[model samples]
Target: MARGTLFSSIAGGGLLIGIVSWLAGTAPAAGVQQQSPGSNPPPLDYSLTADSQPQPGVPTGSLTKHVLAPGKFFPGTPHNYQVYVPAGYDRNRAIPYMIFLDGSGYAGNNVRVPVVLDNLIAKRDVPPMIAIFVDPGVMPALSDEAQNRYERIFEYDSLTPRFANFLIDELVPEVGKSYNLSKDANDHAVAGISTGGVGAFVAAWNRPDQFRRVITWVGSFGNFRGADRLPGLIRRTEPRPIRVFMQTGRQDLVNYAGSWYLENPRMAAALEFAGNDVRIELGEDGHSNRHGASMLPETLRWLWRDYPQPIAVREPQAGAGRGIFAELVPHRELLPPPSNPAREGGAGRGGQPATPPPAAGRGGGPRGAVYALIYRDKPWEQIGGVYKSVASPAVDKDGNVFFADLAENTIYKSDAARSVAVFRENTRGA
Candidate 1:
């Protein structure tokens, strides 16, 4: 039941380009960080000049509309998408390409991505690239008065590989049928705003072999169904060959999901800890496209700055801490054996089983008993059992002990009287 403009394709020559410019002299917003020198050049004025716009003699590209059938990825859901081929596109050459989510909004005049692409492609600031703007799917309502079931939240916010699979398996193949898209991951990029922004990152994260560059603006990296765990995943997983650009605003949404303002920085820190190539830009604006649209031209340039340069993976620094590296890495040290064998349950100097020393204030307790007294003031006793590889032991207030035998995937318990019994059955190899 979702309604919008119908599908249509327009040749580059038929699409009119007009000159529009925004002054870049305005001071940086309150929370905006100034770019460092030699870094991405300051955001240039995206206003189209006569040369930047399509002139009488200037070569222009084409915009084509496409519809993806329902049930192709999401059952009973359909989506509309647009593709923009730059002015210099050559059918024979394998060119760089990018996929943008929230297609209708971005493809419109508000974002004017095609116009930005046109200007940048003309100025040689960015390599000639194809842009695919894809809208999220919608499930139609059965009645006219009923509302349609929008799938944007489910499609964009879920932390699954299905969306990525849809792109890599269905959409990319569909696009490839019409154009010579590059097979090299270096030439592929994915981008989106807000929920779509998170989707963009997820797609590349799940399928780095298909896409290697990511741009996320005001991304919903908060707890929108497990997305907040991405930072931890990034830190724990081995580094992948992907470059990332992230942007967020101080005034972004802070609701039941979580604060976008905080999550973006956390993600950046995790990416940095993992030694991935990542750049983040922050501003005072809210969770809107004002900042993202204004900076899109520069973002595209930075994303593809060194064309064909293979994105490099860095070795995670030692002691990065709080990741798989920290948990699994071994720190070796040399130490002499215990000076007294008796303390380690070994034979004493006289070649007899050594009796452990008693507590300072307690007497008449069993030797080597971990506890000196039971709750009833009875002597502490050891359970009558010989166990193999006992692990993760716990004791109850009633003087009962519970432990697991990981090798057998079984749990055992001991009563106060030193009797042992199986507490549980197979534990699925845990």
Candidate 2:
């Protein structure tokens, strides 16, 4: 049985995972990359301020706050949650979102989240998405003079799926009361730092249907009371609908708990091998929010790169090694054939065949769908099947094309026409 806090509601339930599987990797022992002196620099103490800009078209409204009590097996504890209303968010127009763990971290120390969000919305660097900042619960002491008790790790570090249930079932529905949150999974994101980072991955890993985009800093994916077995579990399970951006420092925790440096890279490699959508940046610093904070603007941009796009999990071809490690994605649609032969071009949900349309001139149109891959630099050039889903296409000065594979967790170049070829996998270490 799993022991952890759970948030449940009528519509759907999510779990806060606690136990982890510690399976190993396939990389050669000799080529493992270690954190370098420059990369593993020290962490920053204070929060860094962000450069703010105008935010037009964002839904503008006062945030509605809430304090709910845990019940049943949960002990009825109280937790705080906040909603961010963009400049022009409308009930009619559904908006995507980015969720935050530990509201105080971003709302206080790293005020840059909202600031960067405002700037990004204005500059069109990314689409406008709502922000949900939540705090872990703390039970009140019996005596008046008793100190307020904290339960950060005990609640966040576990691998059970209860916490995710709380957000989707309890937190999200409550947010829906004030504004319209897109029910579509493609519009959602989740993020955190430290143990919160591990919790973030656990949430998405358990409920990728609700959270397709994830950002974590210094995740604790080690064997601490059974939470360190994620790398192996990832290799064993079929890929889920997720896009993960992981960041960690060399100087992060490396005590009896586990090494953040070693764990982050190992997890990244496993995600790649299991055919997941993942990105990682290894820095030299301790286990703090400084680096996670500094990269907030860029991270948000990457997390929401493929906005309003659904993330699909590609199964490996038969007879492949381990079978589970092979995955693929076609995130973008190629330029339509001058005339679509299949009519609609894209497949139906669940990769099922689409309904047949009327005759060509009467109502039937082009049904053919080409998985056209395009380059950011050369929009005219047609690249096919480079990445499953991409925030933006990668293009070079000479019309070269490249894209990241979430499953292999690698970046590859298509043979001039975006044909698939191996580029680099971050297995050895960072």
Candidate 3:
């Protein structure tokens, strides 16, 4: 089989869309539960696409399962993980690989990762690679009176380098013991959904040197365990060589923390503001993985659209993003001088005229509204002395303007009197 066209890579060759016939109609799956959905969303009768199903002509891969005893990372806990080696994979040559959190979650049911990999590899749509399906660790109960300890939240929800150390220091090296794994960070990817979805980002966020690509489906980047602070973190930190593809539904989780629906978009905006390559898809379904699973085949295509070439951090463009991005606008003329080399031939042989920065108030929209507000009437004035990172300034009905110091996850309010004060602290990226 030959590789697909460039468009096919981005569009997944239109590989999705045949996953179901709606077996249950408007009724939801039995015992389905969520905080936002009063009645569980409808259950889906999914039929696999040719790519997601076993094909008579496609080459199949082998999946081997192993038990992992908890090590220094999380002592006394143990779990299981699986490894996949595509048919005809060479023992001497190293190959790319991916990490899938909530391992068994994606391996079967609607995803059927083994089958999907077989088809994608056979068609040469994605590079031949290995996949690690990782199940969360749990502390076994010692007696009938003792309750078992679940580590999923502490492992996946906390936004720290601990989980990253677990993967990069312990789990990955253990997997490498038996197989020839690629050492290039660009060749590695991490993925997860819901709580595990944020886990995937945390892996790469803390260690861009080990993984450069991130895939999340309805990622729970909310206040569950300080994950909502991710967007602000991205806005202030230097950009990492990472590419991200996230899927969020209109009807996602919402609780005492905040709305995942709002957080995901805000997260995307943060990545954009930080000059990172990011893509997002918004659907109409609930928080369930129905939509994310249906688009799995296509999501992979977009994640690795251009192969071999490394994913790199992009330079922030003036007026290109929301929140802190407005600070990048230029105060001088938008066009280069007529005698400048850029205007002559250095920029291009055709000498195309440079596009001016987005119009001040009209161009940046809400992003620049704060900039306009700051420089309006006269010149920009320093309101406060200390601010690590500022993002999302909005005016209330009473003419009170509020903005966030993303690094601290604190929101500040500037009242009509022009005095700025702390409105809320520990917003968790709200």
lDDT of each: 0.66, 0.59, 0.70
lDDT-sorted candidate list, best first: 3, 1, 2
Measured by TM-score, how close is model 1 to the native structure?
A: 0.63
Model 3 TM: 0.69
lDDT (Cα, tens digit) per residue for candidate 1, span 1-430: 0001001112322111110011111212221122211234334343323332344544567888889887567988878889999986789999889998877666665566787787777778778889898888878997999999978778888789899988888888888999999999998999987778889999999999998999998888987678899988997787778888887755566566666766776776677666677776656555556677777777777788877788987654433332211111123111212224332211101222232222222111211122333233465656656667688888764457789988888889887566899998798555
Indicate whether candidate 1 or candidate 3 has the larger TM-score: 3
Report residue 339 deviation for candidate 1 (angstroms): 59
Model 2: C-alpha RMSD to truth? 19.0
Q: Over 4 Å off in model 3, which ranges?
A: 1-35, 39-48, 321-430
Specify the highest-TM-score model's number: 3
Candidate 3 worst ten-residue window by lDDT: 18-27
Which model scores highest in lDDT? 3
Q: Give the C-alpha lDDT of model 2.
A: 0.59
Candidate 1 residue runs with Cα over 4 Å from true position: 1-58, 318-430
